[model samples]
Target: MVNAFFLFILAGLAEIGGGYLVWLWLREARPLWYGILGGIILVLYGIIPTLQKFPNFGRTYAAYGGIFIFLAVIWGWGIDKKIPDTYDWIGVAVCMVGVSIMLWAPRH
Candidate 1:
């Protein structure tokens, strides 16, 4: 569903962005405020998944792992100025298929 995908993307961005900020603070020496804001956003990332309609926590987080990979690739490409190679695209495709199957496949 649209809502589910949106939530996944939102949560992924929160996690990635938050972590990136913290990375900048500690690794790249950006600022202390960067780490503080990143910590707040990380808290939000933890809460966002609870908004999903899926009842199974494991399934939801498992599927989210795939989404997170996809988003991380995009983030790296766009923000880090790292162009993805063919192997990266292949990996993203595989992860996306796995995510779709896990999220949409029928159950007894």
Candidate 2:
């Protein structure tokens, strides 16, 4: 459970960091060093924890990827001034349902 919490936090931070880079890159920004640094930091944060601790890499990743997509949509609408339409909401719902199944399905 603790690991799951950390994973989600890392995922959100990564999304925010990558989103900042996208915003900067779109503005014809200078000093591109920040982009590389931020990207590496985000990727490392998201990858290291799970790679180091998770027992089932594929299942962990599949579940987190779905949750990441859902959260990205929320962040996009809330912080990026992008309004999500019905299709976006539907996609998020579907992904979240899949995430729940992936994470909770019992193995016998």
Best by TM-score: 1
Model 2: per-residue lDDT, tens digit, 1-108?
667756765776676767577567657584677677767767765665564355787877777777778778877888788999999999989988997787777878
Candidate 1 structure quality by residue, lDDT tens digits, 34-104: 99999999999999999999999999999999999999999999999999999999999999999999999
Worst 10 residues of 2 by lDDT: 45-54
What is the clash count of model 1? 0
Report the Cα RMSD per candidate. 0.5, 2.7
Q: Model 2: C-alpha RMSD to truth?
A: 2.7
**Model 1 lDDT on a 0 to 1 scale:** 0.97
List TM-scores for all candidates, in order. Answer: 0.98, 0.75
Clashes of 2: 0
